[model samples]
Target: MIMRPGHQQLLLPVNPFFLWASLIVALLLNMVPLGRAAWLPDLLALAIVFWSVHQPARIGIGAAFVFGLLMDVHQTALLGQHALSYTTLGFFAIMVHRRLLWYPLVSQALQVLPLFAISHVIEVAIRLVGGGIFPGWQFLIAPVIEATLWPLASLLLLAPQRRAPEPDANRPL
Candidate 1:
């Protein structure tokens, strides 16, 4: 389980604010309209990866499943589709999270890009197998954007806390 230094005692569930906020952001981004491009920014994918790496127990596969359901509902897409993809992605992220933590920015970005891509690929493959034209290359742009945002994402998740070490107490009763 991932944990923040300041949030050591925070072994409980993920905050509702973070969960819903990520969903709202993903939903809003999904609402964007584009005439020439059929691209989505994969904001929710990044959020799931972020929280999974930084707070695994609080935001694990179950969280991914729930969020995927919400996303599918919001987009009116096929049911159990995003949920299945996200659940699989979440499992992979958790399994390899330790190695991901040891990697630097470029390597980490490289590692993460594929996870995001996997979700899209799974979705696309399912649609194709169901009898549909393959989505264009623009469908691939979101993971690149998501990978580029890793630096900003780290700051967003880590820079807010300023925990100071407490001195040991040995007072006699």
Candidate 2:
């Protein structure tokens, strides 16, 4: 692929420990005691999608499913509700990871908007089928928020990898 003039420097190989740690942090964020607000962005979903796109080999559907199950257990919701949502999200993210990386951050977020929306739709459909009440239009706000968060997530999560592995006075990268 042709590089853009301001294309970012080559990133370091992601540390396995940091990769899992970030996922755990995202899970903990979701586990916070805030009341169930339909508009709250799914931080875990954002993290999963980010990693799936940037580090596809490291984080995949299996990790998404495991985290989703953990969320299901934590929130006491339908057993597979989050698992299915995340698995779908991760799958889509992985599918588009290559193409997605070529776009500007803004465009990338726009592209990912649908993935987040679809994941939410799956969750809502499952909830309704499982006899849960509609969460109202506020639920729609989540995907938008998650999409908006894409650039920020990219910045934060990619920070560690962006640094030079070994900064030397003679070499600037």
Candidate 3:
């Protein structure tokens, strides 16, 4: 049975269940006990990029807010600390979303790096104001790593599908 073009475009084989599942996996990756710097993956950022570029309507600032809250809660860092920063970051991401969606992998990584830095900056400002100790330049390292990983992350995460277009009655079949 052939699917209509609209139906084909609209169909979601996995629904949101799969999307949330991927996010959960990202959460796990974030919460993993990785003591070393080399092994860390910017799981949450990567997932946000994936969904932002591919499914902005489904995942946006709101989702980022919730996820940030979750990160704050699970990591026991700060309550609204990450949430505010993440929401602000998400706003910019959404603002540049059209460019992000069309950008080549390397370009996307380059652009997103600064955004990752911006997000981190918000947190750092919060920490600084709250009398958190100077974490030194090491704190900058994670977003650098996170930004560097975007190309690979996007490829692995998006997994684009270009299915054949379905029939339309006006065109010859």
Which residue pairs in model 2 clash with each other? none
TM-score of 3: 0.78
Candidates in order, TM-scores: namely 0.75, 0.95, 0.78
lDDT of 2 by residue, 106-165 (tens): 999999999999999999999999999999989999999999999999999888888888
88-170, model 1: which lDDT tens digit per residue? 88888898888787666677888988988888888778667767677798888877888888767765655433222342455
Each candidate structure's count of clashing pairs:
0, 0, 0
Which residue runs of candidate 3 sit more than 4 Å off their true CA positions? 1-15, 36-41, 160-173
Put down candidate 3 lDDT per residue, 1-173, tens digits, no spaces: 75433352433333477677788899888888775342354578677766766677888889889998998898676687778877877777778887675556677888888888877778778878877766677778877788888877765654433222464777543
Residue 161 accuracy (lDDT) in model 2 = 89
Model 3 has an lDDT value of 0.72
Question: In angstroms, how far off is 65's CA in candidate 1?
Answer: 1.0
- Would you give me the overall lDDT of model 1? 0.73
Highest lDDT: which candidate?
2
Q: Any runs in candidate 2 off by more than 4 Å, and if so which?
A: 170-173
| Residue pairs in clash, model 3 | none
